[model samples]
Target: MMIKSLLRISTVKVLILLAGLMLMFAIACGGDDDSAGDSAAAPAAEKKAEPTVVPKKSVHEEAEKKDDSAASGAAATATVAAAKKDEPTATAAPVASSKYGGTLNWGTAPNNNHVFFQQYTPGAGAAWAMNIGDPLMAYGKGSEWLEAKSMAESFEVSPDGQTITFKLKKGVKLHDGTDYNAPLHKWNLDWVLNPDNAAVTRPQISAIDKVTAIDDYTLEVHTDRVYTPLLNALGMMGGMPFSREEYESKGEDHLKTYGSSSNGPFMIEEWIQGEKTVFAANPNYHQKDTYPYLDEIVWVEIADEQVRGAALETGQVDVADINSKSTDVIAALRNADDIFEAKGMAGVRLSHHNAARAPFDDIRVRQAAQMAIDRHAWNDILQGGEGHVYMGSVLPPTSAFAYKVDEYMYEYDPEAAKALLEEYAAEKGLTLPLTHMDAFKCTDEQLEIGCTDLEKREITVTVGKGAANAARAEFEAAAFNAVGFEVTMDIAAGKEGPRTFVTKESSFSLRGFGVRPHPAGSMDSYMGYGGYWNNGSYGTSDAQMELHETLKLAGQAFDYQEQVRLYKKCQQIYLEHALGGVKLANAPSYKFWTTDLRYDGYPDFTEVFFPSDTSLKMYGMYLER
Candidate 1:
């Protein structure tokens, strides 16, 4: 009875949370208003059109709100030490004991949070909600998929495997004064399937049909379908329980500011919007003495990538974002008096194209795009040789399951691209006609004119199949022009920039450059042609669509042997016919982290201080001298 009362958070923000805001233009990015079943459900179309959202402030406005507007490294260190200033900090089940305290500040390229991600306040999103906040079952930095017990003292999975029960560690307290008890902390996965929550919850708990708590420390989860990675998901923000008092106070997009923790190793003491967010170590943090090596963290957001690079070089910031777009930054860091450091993760790019469209509406067109780009050259230039090129629809070949069969899409042939252009032209019927959006491949000056302008829509793409977006834009412009077809490459900015053409299906074809969630071994990633990512909306060759369910089920199979068998089958699916969006070169995921802040996953800073964290697990991370 006590548990139910505490857990009963009024459906205060539930209405606003009708769907997710993972995409920048969450409502605009989607196609339909009523299709809630799709993970990224479209917003109900507005009865009256709304004006575009213009940024009233700078990208780093929130970070600038802090006291340490210029340099934050010292303030960040003070954060860890600040945690000790509260209560003498303790060691418990989740966070193993260690006596390190200091604040760590970090930055994200897209340094802001949206509505769908309100509950998750980390830089990346809900994915890092664990250690910094709460992990129903935290992933001890070292363990892969195996959740390290945190707020949960110990746990047991039901014999049927659909349900998982957790034993709560005693005397757990939220960053707020409220204490955590069973029913309050307990939530049913079934809520995710509820018609009310269905559209919003589909992406997070697709495998979960129900959740129930038998006791305070024990939970029972029942799956309508076989769910193998449910535990891993539990170690994420989706599984982190919300505080009743804290959740209801924020306004409009208020949920995004629901800042209070139940069991993460660190506690965000204060968030000075546009300045710096201060994260004090959690005195009651389960990981005793081990947490938050520095004192209080003063996380500042610097919008200009160049400025961020400069900050790190001058020690104004400890770490910053790195990826294909930041080649110049990487070079500067490497050349910086050995003071700068960088690390990268390969095989991380996924191609997103509308399944129900022209150009991409044809599988051959999609294949041509995959083969047109000089992937290695792009990686060599942008990723600085740290990147890996992949034609297959999976991570890298390093994994046992990635389909390394016939190296199908590696041919960077413009000739072939030219041939595919003819097929599209022949099919679409060209009356010596050219139609295109003037927005794409345009300089900032050209975009002001808009895509529909009949006069300036055509462009001469000189860079033959450039790299990534540049390559894609050039190929699209070149392809259509070859056959006297018109082209449109919409380059909108803000959340809607890249997808401006895609949402409207206007570009020759678009690449949705975002990474969706999936454990390393899961083959059903958006990259792989699994259910939600089935390319049906973009363009699925008949052969590729047939393997949909096979890969989906194989993706969930906990049995290693069965999963391997299905993976082999799924790879064949892609090889037979290129899916609508073909895998180009995986953008190298980079992390330039400080050696002092210890944690898992190479410089993931969502939890290091406080901003937006979906899943945060602090382990093996202690401050160095």
Candidate 2:
């Protein structure tokens, strides 16, 4: 009876201790009488479970916080240097440790016509498209331009400079898993050379007489003459090899909508129209061991320039496109802490006058028009004082073969221009109010006046897009009107001036001339006989013929000094004759990116344009964030 009583008392004491502990736990958890207290404690518990995001402590951070307009240019440059302190300055990957596995968000202009076939599109547009193939050679991989080897392991030109032998890399495969052999290379060359194909790049390689495949890995190229720019032309756009079998089976327009196979470091995964283009890393890439550090690259289309610039500042985008010619844009970028710029190739602005039609067909009129252009005004007003007006022809003033500024002779002299026009009018017995018709619109029978009033003396000038071009068109019209020629402006249907010039749809238009790697490549395309862009028969005059002949001699000369001498002679003749059109100005192009996007392994990172970059710079690039 006593043991039972003791056990009952011990059980009651243990129950009391357990009840006290439960009350203490409830109080710690905020399970009190007040409902607000419980709600606050619940949020505290959830906050502890969330992950933390650590911000990078970079110099760009301090610069971004400071007002950009107040800071001096020296301070801006120093900030850029500091932002790149931990990054590799050279193109090659750094010897230090690297961390990978991130996505790169790039913002760019929209690819209006999304065509993958290089032959159908312009080189700049094609480069912006999904690059799935490799070129024969590429720039930016070496210290100098146009000196890097790509798909071709090695190449040599014969002592005579008429033939070239290329030893292709053996293990390369096309996007469609086809062997990239000599036969494939031969087929591509044949396709381009065929006149029926109407390949846009045919004129660039017109000197090629034949292509012979010695073996699966060896190929030989023979030119009609000593074509020294063969390597540059072959290594540039429209030279990348595609699968013939795929084209034969799937058809030519298949690449317009479908994603093609790629042998490069990255392959197109998906391209949402007007949205974004995604590129996935190639697992079987040739340089898989050390390259393509990013798992994927997402290119977003941001049409608005201001929004694109803001995206970079907010860290929403890694890389972006910035207009290097805009003073406001340049100033804003310089003020921004994290943003940096890499200068690329220069662009030459040209005024194309139709030689096949009236007015421009007259040498006196062409020379007078060329002399009336104010290049300095264009440099100051259109290019924000960042343009080179010393250009003589297709090549920019920066090129080694280009004519010096002092050698240029087309000075702005409206009085002298008027005298030449007056001489032509008096010689032709043409009156001041004589009407000039749009001859291109009329049939052969109605060619005389083309339904135009004979009393009016108006000449139509086709104007391209952009505020600068509009301003130039107005200036040109006023300049022509000052010489007793009534002027009218016709806005171009498309922004493409070359196509309009080739079709002869307009008597006068403004065209953008891209400077080629070699001087001859540009000269042959625009001025050579039977050239793709030589629709107006530019070298028809005896003076122009002399210029063309000099260009040929320059193209064949092996010695650099001899080539320069001949090229200078050609420029002098071109200016004297005013062949093709007026050379306006040369503007610089640039590539912009945030500090987190690192460009390693690209020796000439600032030399080549980003859209058409083929130096395999993307292989060694990575994201630091």
CA lDDT of every candidate: 0.42, 0.54
- Please give the lDDT score at residue 477 for candidate 1: 55
**Model 1, 561-612: lDDT tens per residue?**
3444454455445543444354545444444544344443323342322211
Candidate 1 lDDT: 0.42
lDDT of 2 by residue, 1-625 (tens): 1112222222332222212111110000000000011000000111122112112121111111111111111110001222333433564434335536678887775643554555444434434332455566543321122322356666656656677777778887776678888888888888778866656667778789999999998888899998665665675544667678877788667766655554566777777877887777776666546556778877788877777878887888887765544567656765787676664435456667655456666767776777777878877876676655644534443344444422345578777777777777777788653237335443444343112112222456667555555776777777667766666687655645444434544544666555454555566666654345543443255554555677677677655445545555555555555666776766555456776566553333432233222112444567665
RMSD of each: 15.3, 26.2
Per lDDT, the best of the predicted structures is 2
TM-score of 1: 0.67
TM-score of each: 0.67, 0.75
